[model samples]
Target: MAEPILKWAGGKRQLLDELYARFPASYGRYHEPFVGGGALFFDLEPADAAINDANPRLIGFYERVRDEPEALIERLEAFDDPDADPDPSLPYHEETARGRDVESYYYQQRARFNRRPYEGAFDPLEEAALLLYLNRTCYNGLYRENADGGFNVPAGRYANPDWVQRDRIRRASDVLAEAAIRNDDFAYVLDAADPGDLVYFDPPYEPMSATASFNEYSADGFDREDQRRLLDVASELDEAGVRVVLSNSGVMYEPYADAGFRVETEDATRAINSDPDSRDAVDEIVATNVPPEDRGSAGQRELSGF
Candidate 1:
């Protein structure tokens, strides 16, 4: 199976089994409005699907991946050159080994990526390569932008951070071949999804606590109002006979349940916390349009058991 191309903050790789178990045996086209990292998308590899996100850079990257994987890989190969001179005194990856300025190259690349011309169409190849490099080398693989919509995550301290995977990119291109990728609001999925189609909503979750809140996936962070709007859209999809599934912080279960959806709690490890001690298991909910037949087994499984 093709793996996720990026290291997204709230990626669902850990919960794949639970998600698969809850999914219908088979369905029509797949729809993921909030396609961060796309762990499940790559896993399912649906022939016909509609994937979307509000992040234009991310959408552009995927579009390029679908249309020009070979070109992206060719550009990404530059990072793997062990002897490539990023500076006179050091190779890009050999800086720490040579006892020279180790982080300067990373910072320079970060600055270059941030300084990319945001006017007209974003540079697909350059932005995509920069995004791949930063996520691999940045602290905790977090993608955060400043108020001016610039990529601003600081460089991480990996002795030798892994660069792009050639094979994975080709595999992802095959999966996205028959899909319609879009950069649009999550609610706009209603236009593409027909009855019997599956739509998964992995929105920026509600904050469980003040210190634990890390919703800055974009400059326009997901707020309570966005959550409310998503709930409304999910409800409308359910009424239209579309199969809807969503993942969010456990605190936002009332509205989903009140909307007549079945909600199940699962333990998820919050791995992106700055404080290492706080990277503990937290509660997350999986809400589905159809009540799970195994509702009686909900309490049988521990929150972290998945």
Candidate 2:
């Protein structure tokens, strides 16, 4: 299966089995609004998909992959070349990794990325290349933005890092051709989804405890209010006869239960945690409106073992 190129915090790579188990056996278009690290989207590789995120650079990168795979690959190749001539405009980091200094290289790219005018014309290839580089080299592959709307994750020291996966990139690009990617609020799915369509909401999880809050991913952080709003949207979709599945903190599933949604719990280890000792498995919830019996033929057989 094609995989996400960027290392996204709260990415759902490990929970794929649980998600697949609960997914409707058959459905129409697939919609994922908080498509971070798109573990589900790429794994499913649905023929018709509407994937979106609030991050513009991310959307632009996906667009480049879908419309300009060759160009994106070429730019990534250039970034991967350690001996390639350096441009004066882009600075390299002082710290050396794998016999190469990349601290300045990372910062320079980060600065340039933040400098790009949001509404102005810019090269999509550059945006894609920088995002890939930062994601690969940044701390735990986390994509945390500052309140000023700048990429601020520190560089991760890796003697030998896997910076480029050309085949994977090409594969993702090919799969993305069947998707409609957008940079919009999660609610945008409301207008895009129809009855029988499946919508998967993977919003930033509501903190399960006082010390576990990692909700400040985007500049406009997702809070409890946003969680309630999302529930409202999911209810609307559920009432409209649309298939809706979602993942969030296990504790947060209480709200889903209260709303009359089916909730299942799974244990997931956080991939981006800085403290190794604190990386133990935590409870995550997979709530859906599609019951096992109504999961169509495929879901029926797949869920039979349960």
Best by lDDT: 2
The ten-residue window of minimal lDDT in model 2 covers 297-306
lDDT of 1 by residue, 216-251 (tens): 777778888999999999999999988888999999
Candidate 1 has a TM-score of: 0.86
Q: Give per-residue CA lDDT, model 2, range 1-306, as digits (tens).
A: 577777778877778777777778788899999998777787777899999998888898888888888887777776643323345645334422223344456655555565544224456788787888778877677888878666778777776666665776888998999789989889888889999999999999988898878976778888888999999999999999899989999888789999989998899998778876888899999999999887644321111100
Give the TM-scores of the predictions, in the order they appear: 0.86, 0.88
Task: Evaluate model 2: give its lDDT.
Answer: 0.78
- Which predicted model would earn the best TM-score? 2
The local distance difference test score of model 1 is 0.77
**Ten contiguous residues with the weakest lDDT in model 1:** 297-306
RMSDs, each prediction? Answer: 5.7, 5.2
The Cα error of candidate 2 at residue 184, in Å, is 1.2
- Against the unseen true structure, what C-alpha lDDT does each candidate score? 0.77, 0.78
